[model samples]
Target: MGIGDKRKSDAERQERRRQRLAVDGIKPMTVHFPDQDRSIVRDLSRRVLDGQSIRQVMRELGGSNQPDGNVVPPEVLAELDYVKARLVAIEREAASQLAEIEEAERQRRTLEAERDVARVAEAEERAKVHTTATEAQAATRAAQEAKERTTEALQRAEKAETAIRRARSLPGVRGRLVRWLAGDVLPD
Candidate 1:
């Protein structure tokens, strides 16, 4: 067959395959064409329907396969790459700041716990001191009561000695009786 006849035969076979796939409930693949030329668009469509990937189709059409590469100029691509890098740097800085903030918060909580423990210890110490002071006050009060009792007993003993001396000086009181009253030794 001639080249044109072979191409026509291939196209007929492709159309029959597409019809069979559609009847079997299978969807046909599609591709986007940017050119306004009817022949080029039809060719790209046929390539896509023939199971060619979008990347292959784009490369075959002399278009960039990278996303947005064809639509954007070289200067725009450079700017976009710079912006993406800047965005990544900013994200990393934000993460670092977040970690620092979390660490600071943890330290603050630890310090607060330490302060609470110190405060509890101080309160316990104050309670102990208060209890000690109460006990000391009670002991001091008991000591003062004992001292007052001893002072009263001493005063009474002095009065009794004075009465005995007065009685001994009377005419009827014998020396022996005076000695007995004074709790002294008597001669035989």
Candidate 2:
């Protein structure tokens, strides 16, 4: 056959398959296996081509899915849920539903309370850290001030010692007073 004729035939075959599958109520699926398992997959494919039942083979291989081969569409399932809720409302007491709502509200309030407690704890911890940092800064300032005072005291002592050395050659009282004030600076 020509390429156009082959294409037409293939399209006709797929359309026929779709109608058959719809009638049979079976879904089609595609599976891919690793190249290393090519031989095993080929054997399964050959069995399916030779008219072996795929579902039967799956059952024999320990699968528990014994479906009735019918699939309910998602739209139908959603409609069923709506109808079920309506039926329950018509048959049950309004107070029962009210109780359920109250329980949900209580759960929401409990969660909010927990979050509030966590926020409070976080704030307290942050305040504590800030206070500690402030105290550390105050301590650093105090140490710097103490070092500056010690340096000034050392400078004054050096000046007094210089004066005492200069006056050591004085004849009498001045020399003695300088020596006494300096103490260890000039020997007797």
Q: Model 1 compared with the native: what TM-score?
A: 0.53
Q: Write the per-residue lDDT of candidate 1 for residues 132-179, one digit (tens) a residue.
A: 999999999999999999999989878877777766676655844785
Q: How many angstroms is residue 110 displaced in model 1 relative to the true structure, after the best TM-score fit?
A: 4.2
Each prediction's whole-model lDDT (CA)? 0.82, 0.79
Predict model 2's lDDT versus the native.
Answer: 0.79
**How good is model 2 by TM-score?**
0.44
Q: lDDT value for candidate 1?
A: 0.82
Worst 10 residues of 1 by lDDT: 179-188
Per-model TM-score, in order, reads 0.53, 0.44
lDDT digits (tens) for residues 14-58 of candidate 2: 889978877766546688889987776677666665667876555
Q: Identify the leading candidate in terms of TM-score.
A: 1
